[model samples]
Target: MAAETSDQYETLQIQYPPSHRRGPLPLPPVSRWALGSVLAVGTGGFLVLGAALAALVTLYVQGQAELREARTELLAAGAPLLPPNSPRSPGETPAAAQRRKDQLGRWLQGLALGWRYHQGSIYFFSSERKRWDDAQLACRASHAHLTSITSAEEQEYLARESRGGTYWIGLVATGPGGSWHWVDGSSYSSAQSFWAAGQPDNSDHGEWGRESCAQIHPVGNSLWNDHNCNFTFFWICKRDLSGP
Candidate 1:
């Protein structure tokens, strides 16, 4: 009877693998408060990042607006516009500013009339011809003097502007032995002078030292030539904007 009972009990018991549990497995206990905390932290981080970006954009826009206002103020102050790499204009007293404006207007008008401005001097080319003395008089009447060429650049410009015509300048042989000088009382320097080949041949060319005036000759490669002062020719005048 005992043997039969043990066999019956063993038949009634059943075995299953650990992974084959019938009902859903129990989950670990989770806190609702912790989940809410995590969500709040994440939301706050996103808000901070968005606020930072907005602040940066606002700063950039304000900076640009300030830069524009500064430029406008500078322009209103009568400051000249310069290149980015150029030096700023120096400050000037009210008197100095007025003086500069007075001179600048005249130079600008001369520029409008096709005159060339350089180093505070405005050069004008005459359409008519006149003797050297008469040309000097005309220039004085116009508040100017006969053009005095100081550098090779000036000579080249005058040559180009002359359009292959003769033009009288301010240089003359004023000294006893044909020493050249400029009309502004500046000594004529050979180093700065541009003379044509075999020029100023005064008496040697039968002028009897009468070729006291200098003229820009279109011939002989467009260089200076000593001509008789009485000869009528187109001339150039220079008005200095630099005050005494």
Candidate 2:
């Protein structure tokens, strides 16, 4: 009976497979090392990608700052930077330049005041009253100067267009008893003068001889008068379309 039991045990041992000798199957040593290597390679690649993204972000920020500084400098130099598609050729056609000028003049006139066009020039009338100095400043802000009358014909035309309203002109005395000149630095000539009779008396009864600024008074055929520079009145702004 002992020999029979020993023979049965040997048969059972022979029938068991070599793989089932252990409790569970285990990975080869090479495969475990390869898996760790792959994880390390992936971590290194992620770090490289993160560094590249940071560099790109810094470059973008610096580029924007440079663009802003360039624009500021251009504005300071009075050289307006137009869009890429704008007329940039140095030898622009006269018709094209005139069209651009007219378009810009129309846009400016439409912004704050109504305008009248005559002889390649645009005249804008102020909607609100302002002092002579304020009016001149406003005109300059609009890329214009206060109206400078050179002829009786021109003065008559302005008076007609303005509908007989009291308005300031560009004529102002440079100093006490000084010569009169237009805002454009042109000397006011007696040949083009349109003063009203007994006007520019330099009355000191109210504000002294400070009445040095000229105005196109509505009374007595729309003639001009030298009034106080501080007096508030409507004004005219004129811009030449042919000007650069």
Candidate 3:
């Protein structure tokens, strides 16, 4: 019999040996609609996947930009030196406690940009120079005071971190009785003092005032030096983690 024709099929003839005579066999049907449907579904799925990936990337970039903007704004506003509040009181509302926690987090985030939280205190080592009095004022502005190293460990850490640079500490010579004193009301003798040999000799540099202010001289060793209060130098300030 002759081959039948159809809109859904394509046919091809297969050659065979003359001894095995037979009529042309019909080829399997190849539907245009099925092929188009498969291509369309595959393409749509790939397009959807690509769009999803693009959306994710866009969201990530937007989130990072917002985060950076928020951090910059927080730092510019300055950080508070006050410690986080104590655990919520029995009468305190949950909303109030949450607000306080969020505020504390903002403070910490701003402070982390320029201060190091260490051993119940946050210390700031400035790279800029200022006079002793000006440096003290700067510290006060930050709700801190020039470093009054209360322990040997603090002294050692300051010396190490401040190596290769001189910094004004809290020590001064004009106490109540013309004795050395720390700005935080601690006497120089109270701290684990490490004055350089022959320091505080009251050298005036042949100027108007005496060498009354103390600075960290970490060149040869972690020792202290007496310098004129008017002298400009880098400074170190520490804010207590506790409240009064």
Candidate 4:
């Protein structure tokens, strides 16, 4: 055994078995005349080519064994098996796409939108409430961002699931008078918003600062509101496929 090595970003743990000797398996002889004069067709070439073929066989067998062992280890640990590295193209089949999504669901486990994953992103709703900044920090701790509602369908789903609970969303005031931004770096200026009537007026209402952060709080059946950043509210976290 050896000590593990770590850096600021990651730590690696590797263990190697003791070394062993390996040699080419015994192979039947191949006549030099069968190959060609171009192979330097000498007696030595005959032996070398035979050994090379045997070595290739041995390497293939060894690689297959290693792959099986690794797959077994992953299964025993309840880990999701990785899919192929190729990107999905139009020619890809539905079965392959489903397998990819299933693998993602297994990896996502405790945090996803149940089975309704949204456009390669998962959602996590916090149980406790916090100020807007603190809520964002909490989501970041999980390698996620505060959720941003991008479409009417998504907003409907969130509102229905929220069940009257106030949640701090990712939108924050980026400019004066109704200008807002989502924290995930997506531009929402021209996008559809769910602002309630007369919302985001930057009212003080005796609070120290004006409303600056957005939430999924409903007023008169509307789903968006601007609240003071200091107010505590449970938050939703969105982790895209690119997130850790």
- Among all candidates shown, the one with the greatest TM-score: 3
Q: lDDT of all the models against the reference?
A: 0.69, 0.69, 0.69, 0.67
lDDT of each residue in 70-89, candidate 2, tens digit only: 44554455543454336644
TM-score of each: 0.56, 0.56, 0.57, 0.53
Candidate 1 Cα errors over 4 Å, as ranges:
1-94, 118-120, 203-209, 240-244
lDDT of 2 at 185: 59
For candidate 2, the per-residue lDDT at 70 reads 41
Of candidate 1, the 10-residue stretch with the lowest lDDT total is 8-17
- Error in Å for residue 8 of model 3: 99
- Backbone clash pairs for candidate 2 read none
lDDT of 1 at 143: 66
- Candidates sorted on TM-score, descending: 3, 1, 2, 4
Tens digits of lDDT, candidate 1, 177-204: 8888888655678988898877766633
Pairs of residues at least 3 apart in sequence or in different chains that clash in candidate 4: none
